[model samples]
Target: MTRSAASVPTFPGSTILGQFARSLISLAKAFKDRREVRNLAEFDERMLKDIGLTRSDVTSALAEPIHHHPSWVLVRCVGRPAEAHKMTAAHKPRPVVPLASRV
Candidate 1:
């Protein structure tokens, strides 16, 4: 016997209420991350550079919409250069030493 669509059970997260709750949680997390980003603003340029970030990065992140997570912007900014550097380094040809050269 085939089960009817009406008889099928829906997962909790697939319900409207569940989606609303998830949205609330995500909003809360964004606000929390924004606060942390604000704290990063207090760091001097040198300090910010130490962590692969700059003052402009913090400013741009803070400029993002309230509901959006600002730290995500900072992460993208910081990660891009590193990722590019890794990609370039990975593709570069390395000198191959002959095994016989090592006595």
Candidate 2:
């Protein structure tokens, strides 16, 4: 009796569950980024200039989708490092190999 690759079940955290968790994390990060952008928009002109930005810059960044990430936009404008925000790709699990398919 042999099982094909398609017959193998993906255990939790191997594929489906891992993808779900990554998506949830991404959503949370996006929300946080959006809030940060909104707060930046509230800053005075002097504060904005200190960060190498203007009112228009904040407006332009806030216009983008939350997932697009405004902090990167600010980093480019300032040409200096600030508080780092990490972004990484989701984990992709390898295809399951059934017992019979093993070399």
Q: Pick by lDDT: which candidate is best?
A: 1
Q: How does each model score on lDDT?
A: 0.94, 0.75
- Candidate 1: 10-residue stretch with minimal lDDT: 10-19
TM-score of each: 0.67, 0.59
TM-score of 2: 0.59
Instruction: Give lDDT for model 2.
Output: 0.75
Residue-wise C-alpha lDDT for candidate 1, range 1-103, written one tens digit per residue? 8989989888765788888999999999999999999999999999999999989999999999999999999989998779989999999999998786656
List runs of model 1 lying over 4 Å from the truth: 1-14, 83-103
lDDT of 2 by residue, 1-103 (tens): 9889989787766887889898889878877887998999899999998877888878887787766777777667665323232222234456798777656
Score residue 101 of candidate 2 by CA lDDT.
62
State each candidate's clash count.
Answer: 0, 0
Position 93, candidate 2: lDDT: 56
